[model samples]
Target chain A: MPRRVALEGSHAVSEAVRMADVDVIAAYPITPQTHIVERLAEMVANGELDAEFICVESEHSAMSAVVGAAACGARVFTCTAGQGLELMHEVLFVPSAMRLPVVAVIANRALSAPLNVWGDHSDVMAIRDCGWIQMFAENAQQAFDLTLCAYKVAERPDVLLPAMVHIDGFHVSHVVEPVLLPEEETVREFLPPSEYPFPLDPDRPVSMGCYGPPYIYTEVKKAQEVAIENSYEKVLETFKEFKDVFGREYRPVETYRVEDADMLLLMMGSYAETAMLAIDALRERGDNVGLVRLRLWRPFPAEELRNVLRGVKAVCVFERAISFGMGGPLCAEVRAALYHLPEGERPKVVSFVGGLGGRDVSVEEFEAMLRRAKERVSSDELEGFEFVGLRE
Target chain B: MRGELSWKELEVGAIVTEPGNAAEYRTGDWRSERPVRKQELCIMCGNCYIYCPEGCIVLKEGRYETDLYYCKGCGICANECPKGAIEMVEEGK
Candidate 1:
């Protein structure tokens, strides 16, 4: 039987890392993410987990250390949030480009200008095109499961790429919830030891991070794009195996109450749970409302999303991060995914940017947002985007 | 220098499977000038051998020569020679 215990989201991530039997962990402390590395440090000190816990000075050094370790055939793990991620911005591309299977857990938080340190999608969205397999977790349980699955997905021979699991900082990272911790033997069976095909060794040395001039840069990028896009199949396969072993099913685009509904609300991260409650209230009032939660961000699951939105009449996307002059990043991507649908089948996508800088997005706000989306669909003159729950 | 593999044959992430594949690249093609050694004026201080950026300077037996196939003709060896035994001459001269 699996052990069920109430664990904080960050602790759940640490426990998952421990069970994954990571050989190295290089991380710098950042808000919401600090607890994760802290717990790992304790585990190492207490001899509970045998791993090299490197205390780096900055996030850049932390990422660089993990990249070096992974290249040398070590199963490495790391965690970061907000500005720490921003500090490691340039280093983020190297691991994926080198095809090193380094797993990182991102406690998603808002970026600075106002210098906020709270939960949001701004951090992850900033590096959406960094060539890593990115996934979002709505709760503590998914955070633990996805962290383990990330290793299995990244270490696959056909999909030798770095992976990141994003948990909304403060909202998901700080929340204490009951999580079923899998046995060590089961995790070991599911995710066997990673064997890198080409690792840096003195006896058999290989040049990594070689300079690519203009002549081959385009081809290199094309190859990377194809690899990431193709890994979608491997991700699904890994999730299926995980479900069989652990009994927890995960999907790229998870839906709720959409069978008979015409209006759909789309969101990612922890806010999706709140949106479900709002959907229930609207359903009780005889309204046709449903919810669509996005789990995979990078290598965007366009096919799965298109299939889910096939018959939906209207879609209201709740975005936690704004793209300034443009609108919500999530809303823009959702619209682009649905752009190919025929005119008669396409749904009117209403964009709503909210919960930025750690601001709370209430259930009442979701209800009002849905009402606004329905009005726009009926009026046939939809507004571009709006900042929901803005004080002004 | 042309690439051996077509774009289709190229591996993802531009990984170089063979060790020391740089040896086949012939970086000497980048040279605008070449370093010529004067054996008569040579002191054999080995400064040129140490300073050569590409490590192309070779001391075989008692003779010191630059491996033109791999040298980029940076002229660093010529500049570092205390006895002026190495000279940078225009390539193909």
Candidate 2:
């Protein structure tokens, strides 16, 4: 039997790391993300978890240390958010390119300019192409579960790439919720000892991180892209195995109340649950509104998304990050995914950016957005994007 | 020579499995000019040997000779030689 305990989202993520029995944890402290690593440091200090907790000076060093540790065949864990993630931008490519299975938890936060430490998708969106398997957790429980699943997916012999689990900063990372804490024996059975095929050992003497000149650079990039693209199947397989062992189900894209509904709101992260409440209220009032929560960001579930939006008349994409000059990052991907659909079959996508800088997107706000989307769908004015809850 | 293998034929992460494979790649082809040794002017101080960027300069029978197979003709040997025994001569001259 598993223990049901109330844990802060950051602590929940640390609990998952503990369950994974990570060998090395290299992390630098950052807002919302600091708690996750802080708990792990205590675990290491208390000798409850036998792992190397490297307290690095900066996020760049944190990622660098994990890359080096993972290269040495150690199952490593790291956590960061906001500016810290941007700081690790250059080193982010090294782990994926070298095929190191380093698992990182990102407590998603907004980028600077105003220097805000609030929940948003800007940080994760910036590194979407960093060649890691990225997933979003809607709540604390999912954050805990996804962190465990990340290890199983990343360490697979076929997919030796790094993975990142994104939990919304403050919104989810600071909230306390009941989480099913599984036993070590159960997790060990589910996620066995990670076996790195190409560990840096003196006896083996295998060369890694070789410079790729022009002649081989394209080939190397192609291989890395193909590896990440093909990792979707392995991700689903691991999720299924996790469901069987842990009795909790997860999918790349999860839908709620879409049956017979005409309008669907698309979202990711913790706000999806809040949006569900809005959908419920709308449904109670006889409105045809539904919600589609995108769980997987990378290897973007195009097929699954298209299937879910098959007959829906309109989709309102609520994004927390903007692409500047363009609209939302996720809204653009959603449009591209549905671009090939026949003119008659496709739905009108209304893009809206909201909940930025930790602004609370209330139920009333979601209802109003739905009304505006429906109005635009009828008027055929659902072309450009809008910034919701903006004062101006 | 690595161009012989297609992208699919290469290793997963473009890892160089064989140690010291850089020796097989002759970077000397990139040279527009080659370094020549003025044997009489040479003091045998081994500055050229120490300064050769590619480590292509080797001691042969108590004298330094640049192995053109690996030398990139960077002129570092000529530039650093204390006695001016090394000269950057146009290739094939």
Candidate 3:
């Protein structure tokens, strides 16, 4: 039977991992993400979950260990944050390139300069091209739901790539919320057994991670590209299956109050909920504003985004991470996605950097950013870069 | 169009040993080289067998044997053998 539990987002993620019946859990302790692995460790020790819980030395080893296990045809999982993720940098390419369906939970946190453990999207945004399927959750419920969806989406034979579920560090990870705990049978029925196309059986041994020369390398990459792009359909299909069994609908990009609205708010992760609050308040003032929250980042929703922003006059792209010299990373990608469209049909896009180092982007501040964006749209002089609610 | 193997029968992606490598390295007759294992020094760790990259090694009676049909004379086994048990020696030397 399904039960409703009031649990923290990080705990919810751990619960989902437990419910998925993962074969291996390799993790290292890092701030804001510590509680998750700690709970998982408790579960493993108490025999509540039967999994090989490896205490890896660092996040690099954490990812590397999961890769070895997943390569040998084990359902593997791990979690990391901030510098921990940055430590796993190079190894991130191995799993997806090998088409291993390893699921990772990334508690979104800021990158360090003076060394701070706080909530932000900097860590996840940095590894945008590592060939992992990326998904963002708006709340603890979404976090729990998306983590299950990630395994289904990744393990699909046509879409055998790794997946990362991102939720803001303290904002979502540590905050307690009500999450619907689906029955074990429901999850088991939805996600089928994952086996390697060629397992590491000694009887019929096959070579993995072979060195490919230039002649065959291009074909390898072409197959990977086709696999990820083809996965968009499977992502939607899994979401539908999830809804049919579990009764929840998740789209690549979810819209909030967008119908009959002129201004669209573009953002991802937990910040979207705060933006929705601002949008609702603005709607009360008779402003035709809406929110478009991006759920899938890689195999990016290029067509879905263009469809959502098709008739909107102006768009304020709120980013939790900066790409340094190139403005916001999400903003740049969104612009590039819309660049090929006919000029007259494109939306006037502006970038806003907010919530760095876990500094709160309150509803009032979000409204202020929207006001500034609206002013830019009206005066036809909106600057490309706008830092919202900063202590300058 | 080449020596020994006709270009017509040579399929693509079939790894071929570089021609005249022994002459370039002051060694005689690269084609005759096969990996030979010193069993006394071997620990039977299977590192050579597992990392063959060509699936060319087989273990029988707790000793490693090389499958010569598909072994392209890569010498990777001799290069990576940690115990130094395997050596690339000319077949008739």
Q: Please report the candidate that would top TM-score against the real structure.
A: 2
Tell me the spans in candidate 1 whose CA falls farther than 4 Å from its real position: A381-383, B26-93
- Compared with the true structure, what per-residue lDDT tens digits does model 3 show for residues A200-300? 66765555555544545666666677778888999999889889988989999999999888888899999888889999999999989999999999889
Best by lDDT: 2
Ranking of candidates on lDDT, top first:
2, 1, 3
All models, RMSD in angstroms = 4.3, 3.2, 9.7
Judge the docking of candidate 2 as incorrect, acceptable, medium or high: medium
DockQ comparisons of all candidates to the true complex: 0.34, 0.54, 0.04
Give the clash count for each candidate: 0, 0, 0
Question: Candidate 1 lDDT (Cα, whole model)?
Answer: 0.90
Q: In every candidate, what fraction of the native interface contacts is reproduced?
A: 0.38, 0.67, 0.00
What is candidate 2's lDDT per residue for A1-392, written digit by digit as tens?
A: 89999999999999999989999999999997999999999999999899999989999999999999998999999999999999999999999999999999999999998999998999998998999999999888999999999999999999999999999999889999999999889999998989998888887777888877777788888889899989999999999999999999999999999989899999999988888899999999999899999999987899989999876799999999999988888989999999888886788899999999888999889999999989888988877798889897
10 residues in a row with least lDDT, candidate 3 chain A: A207-216
In order, the Cα lDDT scores of the candidates are 0.90, 0.91, 0.84
Once model 3 is optimally superposed onto the true structure by TM-score, how far is the C-alpha of residue A384 displaced, in angstroms? 2.9
Off by over 4 Å in 2: B32-69, B73-93
Model 1 interface DockQ: 0.34
